[model samples]
Target: MTTCVITSHGGDFFGNDRHLTKLLTGLADYARGCLPADEREPLVKLLAAQQQTEVGTEQTIPAADAGQFAAQLRRIARHRYLRSTKLAEAATLLANAADRAAADGQPWTWRTEAA
Candidate 1:
């Protein structure tokens, strides 16, 4: 019997931080009126609160419609808007908050694909 596992080695690892940042940044894009005639008050509030937080300090990520935010993220990523370095930085910030909120307050770590 023979088995094979395939994976790419060079493409950058789009880990949780990257994904969350993409989502938050994308949410920010749509929340700013890129979306249709709709109000994004909750999202805007959430963004505002996140923006006020300082790195290496307590973060306050407001609770909002995660499903909606994720959907918007997919839309933005599909349109290739998540490719900007600015958005990537924003994602890192958002992800930092998530890590702080995670159980045990542990920072996310990368694992080998082959492991």
Candidate 2:
């Protein structure tokens, strides 16, 4: 088993304004096709938790959502390559990308549902 960690913070940068839910849904679909069936649930749960946590803790959820998205990319690479090296590499790449995106000038968009 491998562990993936994701982190996000406030900053001004590029790639931050993009809609991450759409991106994440695409990535999840891609992972379902590529990764082992057993691994998919954990990945989904982790992502959901991360997103929810972000929404709860931060006024702006996009950066945290982006971090979760990056974590999914790391999970995909881990499933694909089945190597720690590739997992680490992908983790770094995705983390940086998410950070850059979060830093870009854009408002975080979110909708709340009635319970």
Candidate 3:
């Protein structure tokens, strides 16, 4: 299986490609309306770019922006669109990882592993 891994000092998130895609899409959807264009585009674009890569390719949220992105993830986690789904749990995990990274002043990474 191809597994997605999002990690930081305080937390980590692991899921399969389908779940990863759901989490990313869910977050991006929320960001589109809630965040300004400039603040939303890079993260959304980066996630879109990552989805095109082979499993195991790694990507990072620049440290400077991790906090804002994490906040967005948390909001997505609470949003009605994802309620009662595994994707919501995945979003929460991703948020936790990014929140940890921001607190530690480090970048959070997203990557996949072949198992």
Go through the candidates in order and give the clash count of each.
1, 5, 0
User: What would you estimate as the lDDT of candidate 2?
Assistant: 0.45
lDDT of 3 by residue, 5-114 (tens): 44554342332223455445655666676566767787677555544567767777776687877777677667765655665676677666667778878777766544
lDDT of candidate 1 at residue 23, scale 0 to 100: 37
Give me the runs in candidate 3 sitting further than 4 Å from their true place: 1-3, 10-39
What does candidate 1's lDDT look like per residue over 1-115, in tens digits? 2111111111245333322322343456645654344655655555543333333232333223343543443443344445666554543444343333343333323211111
What is candidate 2's lDDT per residue for 6-62, written digit by digit as tens? Answer: 233212253222223333344445566665676566445543443343332333346
TM-score of 1: 0.37
Clashing pairs in 3: none
Query: Among these predicted structures, which one has the highest TM-score?
Result: 3
Which of the two, 1 or 3, has more lDDT?
Answer: 3
Clashing pairs in 1: 21-91
- lDDT against the true structure, per candidate, is 0.38, 0.45, 0.62
Shift in Å, residue 39, candidate 1: 4.5
Native-to-model Cα distance after best TM-score fit, residue 7 in candidate 1, in Å: 26
